[model samples]
Target chain A: MILSILAMAFREIRRHKMRSALTTLGIVIGVGSVVALVTVGEASSAKVRADMAAMGNNLLQVFPGSARRGPVRTLARPFQEEDALAIRREVGSLALVAPLATHSGVAVAGNSNHFTNVWGTTEDYVEARGFRIGRGRVFRDSEQGVAVCVLGNTVRDKLFGDRDPIGESVRIGSLSCQVIGTLQAKGANAWGSDQDDFILMPLRTVQRRLKGSRDVNSILVSVSRESAIPRVKSQIESLMRERRKIRPGQEADFFVHDMKEVAEAMQEVTGTMTALLGTIAAVSLLVGGIGIMNIMLVSVTERTREIGIRMAIGATAGEVLLQFLMEAVVLSLLGGLGGVLFGLAASLGMSAALGLPPVFVPWIIGVAFVFAAAVGVFFGFFPARKAAMLHPIEALRHE
Target chain B: MTPLISLRKVCRVYGAGETAVWALRDVDLEIDEGDFVAIMGPSGSGKSTCMNILGCLDTPTSGTYRFRGIDVGSLDRTQRALLRRHAIGFVFQGFQLLGRTTALENVELPLIYQRVPKRERRRRAMEMLDAVGLAGREHHTPAELSGGQQQRVAIARALVTRPSLLLADEPTGNLDSARKFEILDLLLRMNRERGVTVVMVTHEPEMGEQAARRIVFRDGRVESDERLRPLEARTA
Candidate 1:
């Protein structure tokens, strides 16, 4: 019996094909947008996480002073090399600490001159910053005062072309240095800055030859174990404060940043964006449901005589209600299925166009499908009730 | 044996007080099993109202109506619908066959409401269609069939459930003279062969004279009741 009623409902919809398609259009668009937006957002968020992981593993940085200006003490000078040494010596959980100084200069190799960033750090820089050499070797600990440099992938490609750059000579702002190694390729970072667009040299080389300064701008530290990060961070902070002669109650001039914290903040931002877009899409679905309700009410009014005839033929009011309700549900489900296909296509197209990986989450599709059916039930109730409540005699007499 | 239908002082009032219209008033009637009763009246004389009450589509505002010894007025809407589905059938003047459905499916409708299985429903509906001389036209929709064929399909539908009481309101009113006689002959044959209690409402005296019994109404009350050897009986 139920199957027959359902078949009747489908027949009714087929009888008015154009109107049924138009009525379901709203749901299709609503579900399509929701799935596309959520899936693309998920892909972008995953990209953010992958980029964060690429930044460094269990890394932390301590800057000269608090970048935040409100109520925190400002340092009068940049961080000296002694701060990096002190953190390495005093913090037992720390595995490696390297003072970093960066400057931008034109690097001329043979006839090629490319502008790139130059970094000055110790022999421990490669291990602490998660960098691997593709060819040749890093500078020896004893070669700090010598003029030698390691080239990044981008700088090597720009200055050396296809030739071997290990023995080539490059001029860094009037100072000549021999290339000792070439770092492996690392793609763009989270901020979209090219990771392989810089050169690394021993601290004395960049400090003496490039910047002519003795102060290091930042210190990069890597912990030996993941669980030791919090302890090492606090120890480094206290050691820096004591080294800088800050009072017990005074706000420290330096700030320590954990890569995990940055990654979490980025995740939160993307999560909120996905939720906001999802809410807007859900509103569209609600509007689509309202459209369904309007059409269903009109359908009930138009088919009054049909309802009367069915009732006169011994159909109960409940049967009429179920028939109309099932029609609405079937319409929404069809729309939802179409929308899922559309959304997947759209997401794939956008992903290809935007250079982001496509992310398909099963739960989101399941939820959207169920929500569409619920919309049918909720919005279809009023019209179904109106159809069931019609009086057989009055309805039969209706013109 | 108990009568097939009994109505005692049944009254259906439309409104209250000074604006009230009494569609049926203090009407007492009885219909025995296997009886072919024709209800004849002019417009506003309440023949249709009487049919509605007898078909259980409407309840009398006062007094009692009993069908097969069960109080119909006391039954709820669902119960009345079930009673109609299982024990009563109706034919309307409009033919009332669903316009877009095939004649076979239209005959199968009452069986569907009865929740009969698909195979049995098709078999029974086919048998009824064959009985109505529409065997080759089972797949034709109402619009594809002529007026007489449409009324035959309606009759097939009405009898598909093997209803004990068949109530037809102006079954031949829309037919030409020949088609009217054809339908009248069909109804008389069903009444005689199946012993189905057939109650039909018509305005033509000739149609009324064809029934085994006739009741005439005027001003919402029965004016004359007569029993005669119907035309079909004398011919048979």
Candidate 2:
């Protein structure tokens, strides 16, 4: 009996080839969209994780914009040089604390002139960021205005080739600096910006010779343990607040940048992207569902006499309903199974093309397949009922 | 033989407008077990309505209906369906097999409604398909079968449940002369060999001559019921 019903379902779907194809197109679209969106989101999250781990996983940032700003995005107050030194001196949970002075300038290295971002800091900056000098030693504290420079990996490759750029010289603004070190290559972060295209200098050299600014753009504070990050971040926030002399409820200019915090924002944005992508893709599935409904409706109309014949042969209303409902689910499920395969292949191809990691997100797979069955239930119910409620005598008389 | 079906003042009214017509009015008909009967009528006669009530597909407006000594008029929809599944088999004029379904599957439908198990249902359906002389054509869908083969398939479907009562609502209405003879031969064989009670509604006078008894209906009442002599028995 079960085989008979299944056979009937198969026959019905087969009879309407064009309609079946059109309906399957819906499932394909819905499942394809969901797969691609989720895979892309997974790839992005993976990228964020790699960045956080590379940028000293246990690091925390203290800024003036946070402690007094609640959860809002605003510049709180400037974190002075005194606060960073004080945190480094006072905090026992810290591994290292580095103050950053950043500015952008045009630099000329052997006729290769480009506008590049420059970061000046102490030796602790390299340790706190888990970066190695890749070629030469970092600058000495007393080498202020000594015109020594360290080239970023991209800058080094673009400026000097195989001739060893370690001894090369570059002009930054009015000051010409000799190459002291070359940075190791690091890839781009979750953001599309290049991570290895910046130039690093000593704090005093940048303060005195480059931008001539005493204010720091940001501070990097590294903790010795991951479990101690929150405690360390809160401690640094209060310390900065005390030193910056900011009143309660008043905004500060500085902010603490934490990996988890950045990840949360990244997750929200990725989530939105996933939904938008899935929603757009899911329209196809909904269309596929409607197609199933439409086909079932047509089948009901065509099989009026058949329904009447069955009723006369002792079929109850529930039995008739069950038969058609089973048929609809079977049809949609077959299409859904085919769609899963199609989506898998499409996502693999897309992932390779986009150069992102390929992930088969289980939640999406479950949602697509089960949701297709649900769609069968959702759309199939009405038509199935109509077929079941038919008066057997009337149906038999249909000409 | 006990009355296998009894209708007390059965009335089936069609349409609700000013042109409302009574298909069956105050019908009280009875058929004994293993009877071969034909309801003969013109196009507008009430024979079809009697067939519908007998098949349990229609309920009387103000009458009592009994099948196998059970009061069917009081039964709920579910109970009535159960009664139809086990007690009645229907053959239709147009041979209304579900399109694109194999002959075997179409024959298996009534058994499915009976909740027959998979293996048993298939076995019975195949057996009936073969019994109707469509032995090798079980896999062929209705569209792929000829008109005669399709009618045979409908007959097999009607008889699969081994129901005591078989109702054929103009069973050969759409068949060619040859196909109509083949169906009539199959129906007569079932009546004579298996002793299955058969009630047929047909407008053909020649077809009416084949049954053991002919009931002629006109308007909303029975015009005459004549005991027709079986061709072979009476001639022999």
Candidate 3:
């Protein structure tokens, strides 16, 4: 019984080459888009995880409040510089502490002015975050209170071109600081902003000389151990409350920014995007299923007399149904296999051609194949049953 | 003599309520094994319905239909289907072969339903096609074959199961004289060579003369039935 059905399916495909190719095309497109989208999404998530680890392997962020409902430490109400120093002194789990300050304006070097943000950190900044110097030397500890600077690769390229920028001067607002080093390029972030286009200066240089005195935007704290992070954050929060003399039930004005927490948030956002794309892909699969049902119905109609002849020749209705159903499933399965092959090739092509990494997942591939087959079964049954239940005598008599 | 097919007071009423129409009424007949039988009548004379019942494609609404002492009237749809597949081989007036399938594939179809093994199925199907004088034409599809050859493929399909009863409906109704004779001769050879019981319906008296027995039907009932004398016996 199984053998006959399989033979019939093979014959049907051979006989209707164009129609079968067209029908299988629907499945190929459906599964192809789904698999490609999923693989790309997985690759992206993995890349984000690697970047987040590189940025801060042992960092923990503490927010003043939960996400969404609260304003993230208003610009006018800045976190105090003393809060960072206190977190460092009170928390024994700390490695190096730095109060982060950002000031965005036009930076002028060699008569070429480019709009960029200047991040202010002290000498300990190099070890606090994993900042590697691509060329020249990092600023000395003596330069913390002086006007010295390190340019990210893009800033160095845009301002100094191929010429050496080390020991040269660049102006941020009214202050002129000497460039000491060029940091390695870190590419872009999830927000589509370049991470390597910034200029870094000594904490006091920006606080006192450029932006004018003592106000810090956020605290960048590096924990010595992953396990001690939560405790260290809580200790900083409590010490801040004590130092600021804030009473019970009053909110603190300061917030901590950690790369891991930001990465988690970014993952959630992208995960939702993947789900949205997945839903669109699923709709296409449903469309493919409907395409199978539609084609099977047409086949049933075209083969009505043939069905009758088989019954007249002694085939049971079940046997007839089995034949058509098997044909449908075989069509989908072939299409699914073709789709997987095409999808993998497309992913690799996209990676090579566009320089976007594509990932491969076995479980997803298996699931897509099964899903396509299931679609065939679900949609093929009705039309096949219709063909089977046809009255043999009447069918035989069909013109 | 064992009766190959017996229908006692068989009636087939179609539709329901006021629309109910009787196709066959009070039909009683018995065909012996190895007999070539023809039920002849005009269109709407219930001859086709009788053929359907005899072929196990339809059941009599009322009365008894028994094949070799088995009450087909009591059998359900599946059992009747099994009987069709295993006990009877059917040929059609239209030469109802699947359009895309080759003659070999068409012949192997019924055997496939019979759950025959692949190698054996193809071997037997080709043998049957060869017996029908369609030896090299096994790979030709229905569209590629002539009317007579298509009918021959249908015949091969029917005989592949090695069924005892051969049921044919208007076997030559659509063919030219030459094609018609070719089909008739094949059926004759099958009946005489294999002792296969043959049941057919024909519009032409010349077609009826080929059979061993003649049953004339009109108004959904048997008008006359007679055991036919063979031409050789008459000449002798």
Top candidate (TM-score): 1
Quality of model 1 by C-alpha lDDT = 0.88
Candidate 2 TM-score on chain B: 0.93
Model 3: CA > 4 A from native: A58-81, A101-119, A140-143, A146-148, A165-180, A204-215, A224-231, A341-355, B229-236
Best by DockQ: 3
Which 10-residue window in model 1 chain B sums to the lowest lDDT? B227-236
Question: Model 3: iRMSD?
Answer: 1.0
lDDT of 3 by residue, B1-236 (tens): 45778889999999989999999999999987778888899999999999889988889999999899899989988899999888898888878888877899888888778888889999998889889998889899899999999999988888888898999999999999988988999998888887788999998999998788899999899999987865222111
**Cα lDDT listed for each candidate:** 0.88, 0.81, 0.83
Instruction: Give the per-residue lDDT digits (tens) of candidate 1, residues A1-399.
Output: 889988998998899899888888888888988889888888888888788767667899988765335766456567888888888888887778889988888999888999999889997888776788899999977887689999999999999889999988999878999999999987887667898999989988888888888979889998888899999999888888888888898878788989989888888887898788888878888888888899999999888988888888898889889989998988888778878888889999988887788789788789779988999999988899999999888877776
Clashes (candidate 2): 17
Q: Show where candidate 1 strays beyond 4 Å.
A: A66-76, A92-95, A224-228, B230-236
User: Model 1: per-residue lDDT, tens digit, B1-236?
Assistant: 78889999999998899999998899999988888999998999988989999988999999899999999989998888888888888888988878789999999999999999999999999999998889999999999999999999999999999999999999999999999999999998888877788999999999999998999988788889888764343222
- Return the lDDT, model 3, position A276: 94
The CAPRI-style docking tier of model 1 reads: medium
Model 2 C-alpha RMSD vs. true structure (Å) is: 4.4
lDDT of 3 at B77: 80
Between candidates 1 and 2, which one is better according to TM-score?
1
Question: lDDT tens string, model 2, A1-399?
Answer: 566567767877777778777776776667666666676678777767777777665878665454434556655545456767899887778898888888788888877887888888787887788777789988876875566878888888777766588888988788888898987877776676787888888877787788766777678998999889888887877777677776777655566888777877988887888888877777777888888888889888988877887788787898788779887887777777777777778878877886777776778777777977887888889999999989887887776
